[model samples]
Structure formats: structure tokens, C-alpha cells
Target: MSRPNPAVFIAFLVAVIVVLGSVTLAKGGFYLAKHEGDTLHLLQILFRMASGEWPHLDFMTPIGLLAFAPVVLFLNLGLGVGISILLSQVLLAFILLPAVFWAGMSRLPRRAAYLFGLSVLVLVMALVHGETERSVSISMHYNRWAWAVSYVVIVLAVLPPREIRNDVLDGLIIGVGLAFLALCKVTYFAAFLVPVVVGLLANGNTKALRGALASGLAVALIVSVFATLDFWVAYLNDLREVSASTVRPAPGFGLRTIVMAPAYLGASAVALGAIILLRQAGEMTLGLALLLLAPGFIYVTWQNFGNDPQWLMLLAVLLLVPEVRPELRNSFGWPLAQALGVAAAIAIAFAAPSMLNLAYSPFRHLSLDPADYQPILVRNPEHHDLQVREIRANRVDGVVALDVPGSGLEDRVGKAKRDEERVSFQGTPLPYCELQMGIVAWFEAIVTDLEQNGFAEGRRVFVADLFMGHWMFSSLDRLEHGAPWYYGGLPGIDSADYLLVPLCPTSLSVRKDILETIEESGIAVTEVRKAPLYWLYSFDRDG
Candidate 1:
């Protein structure tokens, strides 16, 4: 690494404190603009953890424990979930501060290093998931945190130090970053693991490899000691179950589209061009490492919900740092340095929208009028700080296809012989109904009705739909072994006293899958009651 710049590091620290503090002070509470469903799912995990339950053992989820651990820690300390979230991001930034500092100071110029640190911190602290959207929400926050770690890891691995070299620090950063990925989101670990190792080796940083291995192992040992060795088995089982389940395999576009679709093709071209330019500039080792990382980059983007190519900033940074001679030129006779600069600009252009959105979110949150929002977890007045739009919490909306038989719309749409594909429960054909919004209202109403009907506190009713966030709002007990968001295979069903099937489900496909699976299992269930919201059926455990 180059001689460390104290001024740059100090400036970065000040920026972190000022930015995060300003946002926290501005909101006075956490405010969400959208994605209430995701927030509720997060609350379920946090609620369970706060209640002394363990993930994988007490609930089913493919997400790793570290994803929720930081926030849960603050929650257990008596902070509201909203502040817990903000504090967790602050904690993550500090946890990663040394690595970001080392990587930035080692590879980048003073200004670039400061920007690098600031960017990573902004991503970690941003209230919204990445996109061009101006609205703020803490949806898919773990994804953002994983991407921040990835940015640090890639920079550290791909760039050799300019002058100073601390092999121990380098290895520890790589190891801790990778271990965090494994414990927070395994998809990132699986995607970048090989490439990171190859990058370190290709750069001839062999001395750091042993430290990396030791650090990673040490992290694993600690987790096993606390969460127990069986945690790995349960974790893997959740992963395997989700992998096999047809529900929500991908959040947005498919893998192929993420790789080569029109929206993504330009970024792919920029990455390839950067790789080739690095090779042409005679930086063969870095080029090869980047080439290997390209696929992993695409895989991570495909796995994330919005498919935001957050790695573009890292690409830009890498392009800026190569010390190629001024005279070097590619086949087009374009000066290699300028070519790299132009490529970097294009990468920045592709990433600008999301980056700007992330950087500006805290300030935007400051401008929101508090009178417009309401507490999401209505029963938990202590968590009144976590707020959402009142309309979103109260107004329910759904979409149902028109079934005008005489109009022949069904036939024209190829639904004439849809019987084989129709969703049915107990020999009854279900309509095409899907809830689109007001998830808070949906769950709150169900729980309220359930309590009023004498199916009160301590009851564990498994909703036959995608999300089971019922316990977060009411006195009802969280379903043992239940999934916050259903990935499939009827998790927690055996432990459920009653199955509540929503007439209009959040995901019709998930409801269909769950009901079919239940029927195949031959679990006898008799109707208990029916309401406008859902049908409650008690399991005939003896039968």
C-alpha cells in the first residue's frame, strides 16, 4: 500500500459522522417510502431474535444470521427497530472502517481514496435499496451491506500496494470481508470467493494468503462456538430448501437478461473493455483477475433484486489507478490512459443514478413531513419511530383479472382450457386474485379479527401465502419454524394450529403452491371460521 494519507482518512471519518448523524437527526425516526412488505419481513426476523429465537433453528430463511444480528443487538438494548437499523449501519461502517481505509489509502490517490471511503459509508448508511428512486426505504438492506464489503474486498485484492505493504492487514481484511459475506449473504461469498483468492495470488500477494485463511477460520470457529456447530447444518438446509423451491427464485430479471439484456449490455461492454484495456496497458495480472471477476459480478447483480451494477464504482476506481505509460495505445491507437478514463467515465455514468440516490437519501429523509407517516408496528408503541405512510398501512389494494366469459377474453388469452392449471382448494377453483399493496393493513386486520374471534394471544396461525408477518403486529405467537417470506415446502405448517388462507394472496402463485403441497401431504384440516379477509381451518392432528 502507498504511504497512508492521514488528512484523507480524517476527512473521511468526519464525513461519515456528519452524514450519518445528520440523517439520524433529520428523521428523528426511520421513515419508509415504499416496500412495506420487505420491512415487515425484516421485523419478523428481528422480533424472533429479540424473543430469544435463533434463525434456521426457530425459523426458515436462506439469509445468513449476520444480516439481522447487528440490528437485533440494538433492538435488545431497548432501542426502537428504526433507530436500531440506523445504528446497525453505523456499526457496520465502523466495523469495516479499517479495511476501507487500508484499501483506499493503499491503492488510490488522496481525493479518490476519500471518495472511496465516503461511497462505501454512504452505501452502508443509505436508507433505501439502490436504484434511481428518490424515495427512502430500508428494503434489502443486507444486500447493500454485502455490496459495501464487496467493494472493499475487490479493491484490496485487485490492487497491489503502491509502496507500503502490510500482508497481515491485507489478509485480515480479505478474510473478514469474505467471512462477513458468508455469514450475511452466502450468494456474495459463493460469487466472489474464487475470484478474490485468484486476484490475491495473481498479484503475488502470497504472504497474505495464510493470514486470510486463519482469519476466516477464526470467524467460523467463533460462530460455531456461539450459534453451535449444528447451525451450519440448519443454515445449509434453509439454503437447500430455498434453492429447490420455485417461489421467488429471482426478484427481477432472469440471469440471462442480467448478463446480456439491453439495459445491462452497456455495463457488460464497459467491464469487458476495461479488462482488455488493462491487458493492453501491459497490466496482465490485474486484467486476468478482473476477467475472472466479471462473471461473479454478473452473478451478484442477477441475484440482487434491482440488478444494480454497484461494482461500476469499483471498476471506475480500478481504471483510475493503473499507472500505464502515457505512450501505450490499444489497437484503435487510442492512448490507453485516456481509453481507461473514458471507460471509467462510462462506468460512472451507468452507476451515477443509484450512487446519487444513495448519497442523497439521508438529506431527503430530513425533508419529509413527520405528520404524513404512521407507526408500522402499531402494537409496539416503543417502536413508534419506525414509520410508514398512513395510507399504505390502512388502504388495501389487489388486482384481479376480468372474467367476462361472453367477451371471450379468456379464450383469446389462452385460458379456455385452464382447468389443469387452475388453483383449487378442496375441489374449488380459485379466482386470479393478488394483493398489490397495504401489507401492513392486511396483517393487522387479520390479527385483529383473529383476536376478536377468540383465536387470541399465543396462537400460531400459518398464513397460506408468501409472507407470514402476523406475529410482528399482534399478541399472536410467531409460528415456530415459520418462514418470514415463504420460499416453499410449507415451513412451520406442522406446528401451526390453524391455516389462514387469504382470499386474495400477496403472491397467488405461492398460495397455490402451498395449498397443493398441503393437500399432497394429506394433512386433514376442517374449517373453523371464514372472514372477509381469510378462511381459518384447524388441523385435524389426530386424524
Candidate 2:
């Protein structure tokens, strides 16, 4: 064997560095919750899993399991939240880049492949660091990553020259990849399936197709069986508790949001164009389409649900078109086709720079330290100047008793009694419990750390903001016990001994009510605070 081309090796190395560096920079300070509701659910799952409990169905996003389960199980090794998150980030970077590069290099010309790799790097960086609150955190968005991986697999699977000998293996690989992709986000399963089915029929191999179908069915059956078991044993129980709880529904994406729509359209157009170009280009088309569509498709999928079909459309375009193979180029005097190919390449290159720039700039900002600008906690006397101390804490494993203002039949009757004063309605649908855009990750890191440090079974009762309560406790746990404040109304005040609230500007603004609630309940609140900002709360059972 002759020595490998140094240029190709350099290109691959550069691609790897760019992808890894961008991801690392974008995820500066590790992962934090971009959405509170999702974070809470993640934390609940982490807590449950740590305690040998299975996750409920709603919490089991396929992407999350792919990225997080391994990290949570293997790498955590009983470390604090901050350390675990940092390790997870490292692991993600390592796993994501190689997989991405493998997908790109298998098809495109070396230069185009490198560019494609760079584009993926830029796109991920941009999304991770975008100022929009929804961009951060991958816990609930496992489908996005799965789609990226699947796009690559689909392209490669379709690229090889049709051969009976390779058919079974190819079918098996595609089937399995698609199955996993589907598990992560069911919508994506449809996208991959279209191309797989088309390829099987186009190849005219009944045995190969049947084997592929059987493998897919087997995988699906296995997953469904586990899912059903998990649901009956864990999810159903959680669901009932959540349904009966008084916590208001967390906000969702607004109907008028323009971001998801435009992104979808742009992605669809590019993906379709790529597929068309690839298919018309012949044998290399599948690989080319895969390389081109992976980044754009991943980005769009992360932003919205509808773009996966667009990716599939692109894949179809690649499969349906027939062009001269790269190796067969000298056999044909196809001047017009060659010109079209050159033109497509140029168009793709022209569009790439702007897209790369769009993805890279935002991530640069994410790497900055939040503490550089301001202290972690400010104002309130109880939490003032608390940033310097180290608060050794661990995840305390007790069922979080979350209460909403209007939870039960009895509470509704109580609402009628206090309707005249209007004070009863005042606290209904409490605003403080609402999930903030970027706080969930912080809470998760904290809880994860706390539990690993022997706090899993601790008796520290958290009397927290409505947002915190909603996120930290399951609906079932919240409903069965009323709010922590409700427990304060009991004969003894030992139930809600700790009140944890984030020390962001919003939390500082609500300092008065938070403190007043703690004081009126006769509980001594101690802020074990440290920060550029911190989650501030008092932790005393009795005043």
C-alpha cells in the first residue's frame, strides 16, 4: 500500500478541529437549560435513574437517550453537576465530529467534503450560541442530532453501486439506522424510510428488501415492548400525578413565531436542490446529497418539525436522477451535463459562506463568562454578598412536593371562600412558578451534583418559585402533596425547610415576596450562595 495522501489527512484533521472547537466554544460553561420545563423533566429523569427507577415515557426523547444516557451512566462516575456536564460536553464533541466527518468523506470530493464538514461545524456553533433563549440545551431535542446522523447514513446507504452481494448488508445498515433515527424523533423515521423503500424497489431485490424490513420490524418490536413496559410501570404513574397537579401549563412556541417557518423553507430548498444535483450527477450523488443535506437538515430540524420531509425529498431527488458516474466521466461527451454540474457546485459554494458565517458568530458570544459582568446574587439582605462562599451540596432525593394555587376540589371550595377578598384568585396560576428560558440547565447541574455527593436521600425540602417547582418535581408529586407552602400551613413547619430561587434579575425583583413567604411561615432561610449569580434560598426548618 502506498502512503496515504497527506492533503486528505490534513483536510480531515482540520475538519475535525473546526467541528470540535466550535462545539466546545459554543458550549462554554457546559450545557444549561434553554427551557425550564424541559430541564425539570430531565432532572426528574436523572433523579429517578440515579435511584434505580426507570424514566417515564414523556421524558424519554430518543435523542436525549442517545446523548445523555451514556454520559449519565458511564462518564458521570459520581461527580458533581458542573463536572458531569463538562465531561458530557467533551464526550459529545468527540462522538459528534468523527461521526459527522465519516458521513461527509464517504461521498464528496475532498475539498467539498471539507467544506461540508466546516458548514456542519458552523451551523451547530451558531444554533448553540444564538441569542435566542431556545437555542441552548440538547436534553429535549435529541431528534435534532439523530436527524443529522441519519441524513449521513441514508446518503451513504444509497451511494454504493447496485450489487447483489452488498445488498443485504446495505439494507440492514439503512434499516437499523432509520430505526434508531425514528426512535429519536418519529418524524425523521418517515424521512429515512422514503429513501430506503425507494432504493429497495429500484434495486428490484425482494430478498434484500424483505430482510431489511424484517430487521426494522424486529428493532421496532423490541423498542415498543420496552416502551410499553416503561409506560405501564413508570410513565403512566407519572402521567396521572402530573394531570392531577395544580401547576399551570408551561408556555409553548407561539403560532406567530417566524423563525421556525423560514428556517424550514430554506432548509427544504437547499436539501431539494442538493438531491437533484446529486442524483443527476449519478453514483456519487447519494454521498454528495448526504454531505450537503446533513448540516442544513440538522439545523432546520432543531428549529422545527416540518423540515425532515424536505430532507427526504432531497434524498428522493438524488435517487431518481441518473447521471454519468465519476469513474465513467471520459466515456461520455456530456458537455451540457458537465456544465450543469459545475454550475451546481458553484451555487452550493456561494451559498455556503453566508450560512457558515450565520452559524459561527453567535457561538463566539456564548463562550463568555456570565460572572464577568455582574455578581451572581445581589440586593436582598439574606443573600447579599454570598458569592464568595463554597456551599457543599448534593442532590437530595426526596419526592419534591410542588403545589399550584388551585390544585384540588377542596382548593376550589377554598377559592370560593376567599373570592370576596380577591386574594384567593391573586395567587391562582402563580407566575413565579413559570419556567424561564435559560435556567433549567443550571438547576439540572445543581441537582445532578447534589445527588452524586450523597444528597440523594437527604431531607432538604425545597420551597421554590412556581417555575422551579414545576421543573423540579413531576406533576404527580406536586399534585399529591400541594405546594411546599401548603405544607407550611400544617401544625409543624418542618416540611418546607429550604427555598431555592435563582438570583437573576427577575429573581432579585421578586425578592420581597419570596422573603415574605419564608418569614411568614416562621422558617429560617439561609442563602448558601456563591455567584456571578446563584440560586438563592433559605434552608431552615424552623425560624
Best by lDDT: 1
How high is each candidate's TM-score?
0.96, 0.51
User: Model 2 over residues 330-429: C-alpha lDDT tens digits?
Assistant: 3344443553455455445434444444354445335544443221122223222211111111211222113344554554555444322111111322
Which ten contiguous residues of candidate 1 have the minimum total lDDT?
Answer: 413-422
lDDT (10s digit) by residue, model 1, range 5-96: 67758666667867776676566689888899998899889989998888898899899989999999999999999989888888888788
Candidate 1: list runs displaced more than 4 Å: 1-4, 405-421
Error of 1 at 161 (Å): 1.3
